[model samples]
Target: MEAGDIATWVGVLITLGISVATYVQSRRQARIADEANIASQEQVEAAQRRAVAVEDSLAEALRLLAERGLTEAPPTPAMSGGPGAVRWNLERRGKHSYLLRNVGTATATGVHVDRNRATPIVRNMPENATVRPGESLQFLMAPTFGNPLPGEVWVVWEGQPEAISVPLP
Candidate 1:
């Protein structure tokens, strides 16, 4: 062949080789992308399985609590003995009996209700009582003919500077 023809043939061969290399590179990229997609799908499936396991565990715990006749969960204790650490409330258990509960984390010592004009006669009131967390003291309140049940009572305890008025429920 002539020199010009040989140069033209060489140019055609180089173009063909570049085209084949490009095709191969594109195929490799496509394969890598497909593999990454598959790995992402597997990760999503694993996360879904973990979520289902956690949900099943929570359901089992609730079922156990129900079987034991504990329908209500107890309150979580406070983290520290700060402003909202110590709290008290009065709950009526019966017609004459009441429960003074310490619903706080800190201990309440020397707990007593201050008597007022509208206060009823309280029986079994403990003297300088010590109530721990989640504990309660039972007392009987008898209302006379003139004085009915008080709307509220003043509660005092150790570590508390002043008496707190708790409304009756």
Candidate 2:
């Protein structure tokens, strides 16, 4: 073959290689763009899920506050030390007394009281007791062992999903 013909064939081969390389590069770029788009969509979906969770949490918190306002007592101390003197004592030495007075408008039914975050004690409230408005219930805690720890009261009443917590003095 002639020198000119050989040179022309080499030029054609180089042109074909260049075209192939360009096509491969374009395909890679398209794949990269598709991956980026998928990642962006996943991020958006995650953010939407988080927002929905936050909204649900806020709704539950509002409902709990409303329930407490309707049902929980206003911590009215009953009169102690005979019938004439009006006094309320939560704790006195080894004897611990909790006084729960229902000052809300609604009556609390099936009231149960217990302590929380302390050594396991089997003391519970009276069975099937109901507290009307302006009425009160009393619970006593006497630790047989070590000194009493500052504890909280868990009050469960009827028609309420969560318990009402009262910290004792």
> Against the true structure, whose TM-score is highest?
1
User: How would you encode candidate 2's per-residue C-alpha lDDT over 108-154 as one tens digit per residue?
Assistant: 55666544543344333333455555656554465556655446666
TM-scores, one per candidate: 0.49, 0.40
lDDT of 1 by residue, 112-160 (tens): 7776533467755544666668877766677889888888777888767
Best by lDDT: 1
Model 1 deviation from the true structure expressed as Cα RMSD, one decimal place: 28.6
The Cα local distance difference test for each model comes to 0.72, 0.56
Off by over 4 Å in 2: 70-169
Question: Clashes in candidate 2: how many?
Answer: 0
Error of 1 at 133 (Å): 0.8
Going through the candidates in the order shown, the clash numbers are: 0, 0
